[model samples]
Target: MTVILEATERRILQNPLENPEVLIRIVDDNQATCKSLQFFLEALGYEVRIWNDPELFLKEYKENEEDGCLLLDIRMPRISGLELHDILIKENFRLPIIFLTGHGDVEMAVDSVKKGAFNFLLKPSNEKKLTETIEAAVKLSIENHLKENNKTIYREVFDSLTPREKEVVRLVAQGKLNKVIAADLNITEKTVQQHRSVACHKLSVRNVAELVEFLKVLEG
Candidate 1:
């Protein structure tokens, strides 16, 4: 078990998108099912958590938890997977979700995907399919987290700029030359150049291409 776990960890580390820190939350009423999945997923190097009660999971879930995906069983008691998914959406939850369903629930699973669930798997899910789907979902979760983090950083940095610096950055992103910006702003070319240089330095962008990219985060 130790050797297999170590090997899986190494394999996950080698993939750029896969991180051992990614948490996998499983919600199912069946104790046997939860135990089986916890063992399988942990062997693949994920941190696994299981809940036999959907309401308990909801009560304990933290909205701003670390990067991860939810492995939810669709036909749980008290609160169905689809109902929980709707609640999470209304709560602005961030983690990607993959639903586990039996063969008869295929249509419902498809509808969930249409409504923005990451994906779904039939019960007795094939090992290869489960691994691939989880990998993709976790990759998406990490990417989204990075994008939001970058947006926050960019917003703070942009807010720190002087008004003139912000203006110069906007014009530069619009592909205006320094002399044109100077003329438009009734300033000297040297002053425009200085503003551009200071702005670029503050934003840590090396060139116009990077500057444009930085501005895009702010715009978005």
Candidate 2:
């Protein structure tokens, strides 16, 4: 079946950042289904990875390090899609997952969603729906990946701050006056100002407000 996408979807695909080496991982034991889905997604300009064994998919998938969404089948040999989803969560795998279900597996699919799967597709899924779902999943994967990357970068920057600077900045963000910060840290007000200035420069923020906002992103 031919995949049909709206103009917005096409525009999103055109943006280079949206395409980031992100993968669409299919974990279905059915070889034919995996091959067909792989071909369809690749034709639409996505990198596809297929695993016929749920165990292998789990073993190979690297949490936080890999950028992708999972396309998991709800029913499989040895490990069902639901069971695999549980395993991933237990292992702290945060990749968005989309389950593929047959007609009789609706209940299980719904359960997967409740347990944090991105969404699900039915077997013989509509070409348009499948394309759209995969696109949405990939976009989410990229977003999550960038967010985690920022968290790492921000954490490193925060770590680079000296203990005095860290204390000063924390107080500054809490609306403490420089004099109060100096008294709290047992330093001169001028020294507090110096530490705050250095921290703002290291964090690339202009003032306490901006630094607070930057740290909020890290909190997420």
Highest lDDT model number? 1
**Model 2 agreement with the true structure over 13-60: per-residue lDDT tens digits:** 446235557778889988999999999888887788889999887778
Clashing residue pairs in candidate 1 (N, C-alpha, C atoms within 3 angstroms): none
lDDT of 1 at 157: 86
Q: Which ten residues in a row have the lowest lDDT in candidate 2?
A: 1-10
- Give the lDDT of residue 4 in candidate 1: 43
In model 1, the worst 10-residue window by lDDT is 1-10
Q: Of the candidates shown, which would achieve the greatest TM-score relative to the real structure?
A: 1
> CA RMSD for every model?
6.5, 6.8
lDDT of 2: 0.78
Model 2 alpha-carbon miss at residue 123, Å: 1.7
User: Clashing pairs in model 2?
Assistant: none
